[model samples]
Target: MNQGVQGPADTGVPAARGRPAAPPAPSRPDGGDAGPDTDRERAADPGTVRGEHTHSERPLPRPRPAVQRSSVRGQVLDALRTALVAGELAPGEVYSAPALGERFGVSATPVREAMQQLALEGAVEVVPNRGFRVVERDARELAELAEVRALIEVPVMLRLARTVPADRWRELRPLAEATVRAAASGCRAAYAESDRAFHRAVLAQGGNDQLVRIADDLHRRAQWPLVGGPARQRRAELVADAAEHTALLDALAARDLEVVRALVGEHFAGSV
Candidate 1:
């Protein structure tokens, strides 16, 4: 608040530790030095030489530059990934980069970058001389990812129930509520988004970043409505999924890993 009273030599500049602070440079013809040079220095003494300013005893943290907007290519890539998961880009289909670039209002460069990212993530396969092909999920890989998530995430939620601070529950309840509302409203996309939030909340224990990232890919895959019989084809069919989450929460509140594992396993299998 005080801006530190321009401490020490009191020139009002934040100084780096071993550098000699410079004296204020001569003002420009119109007025101030219309650039960053002025902000960087302040007079340690009224009439000192250019290099006479002393480094501040107390170091102030420098502010980082602001973030720039995402490039057009990045936006294109994001759009492609979304389209793929939404099933708009049908599984096992080949897409033309030029066509996609036109659809997304981008050049082939960004489209290509986005496709490469997807390919690396296993969402698409590279065909060497050919451009790229839509990724088709294998039943076995899908099952494996789902099962691994259940193994790790269910227990994490149980831990959350046991040890999560009372305040965190406040943050978590809303995601569950959102999941419920999305389901009731029959919005498949919203339901899936909220569903992912619920699992992330459960696994917030231990600040386990590595586990969280691995689980996200699997969660993203599960968000799409799986192709199946007529009963499962309705939008947001898993709206009632709250019951499954409640089951995990109950086991977590009870601090029961066995129940947690069983509940998570059932939920993962049920999604398929």
Candidate 2:
């Protein structure tokens, strides 16, 4: 089980990954070790440096600051979204705020705040004091979202395929390649972010900001990974999906309207 969030009174906070360690303290002017007087003085003062010269002599690090609950809530909400997509959080299953807070290594306040936003997005429903229940999406609802997206996006994609400059398509190649690398690495979070970026770059070429935003929301809802399984199979599936992205870019660059349209339809269909 995931450990609970460390509060101010806790002994230590989990170190953030990839954070560089502080530099070692400079040696004493006389090159003498800290004497008992120095140790006693350091014990009484939080700011004094008193440790061995091999390590940083600064005071122990404290728990991460939680002054900005709003920012923290946004991060928690994103994590919840990924968890839901990965099948780590099941549909129709009720989850308590404390449980989610512990899972996220945050206080219950921010977790509750995040659930409220998810409720607004229709991803979950409040259950009074019991917490929130994940909302189940039926096939009809998924179909409807796809239909709306197709209506708004398919025409734009088709038009961009014919009208957009080849230079623009070339510009998007890096984003498509990033998705492939992310999938090949078998990192779901990396792939998800890169996948969304690839789609957004494609849609933005049409020059319709509102349409892009709407289509992005629909895409996210449809892209949730409901099937949980072995890592190898998941990696293969992700690689296949990434290949489709590359194929779509190739078709667009070639100005193959028929192929582009067909690929777009297949992409949307795969999501549902």
Per-model TM-score, in order, reads: 0.64, 0.69
Q: Across residues 93-120, which tens digit of lDDT does each residue of candidate 1 receive?
A: 7887878888987777778878988887
Candidate 1 has a TM-score of 0.64
On TM-score, the candidate that comes out on top is: 2
Show pairs that collide, candidate 1. Answer: none
- What are the root-mean-square deviations of the candidates from the true structure over C-alphas? 14.2, 17.9
**Model 2 spans with C-alpha error above 4 angstroms:** 1-67, 225-233
lDDT by residue (tens digit), candidate 2, 1-272: 99876543353755566985443444555576544466566677765444344223444668676776668888999999878666677777899999999988998999998899888777889998899998877766777777887888789988999898888898888999999999899877678778888999999988889988887887777755442322122787788888889899889989999998888887776553
What C-alpha lDDT, on a 0 to 100 scale, does residue 199 get in candidate 1?
78
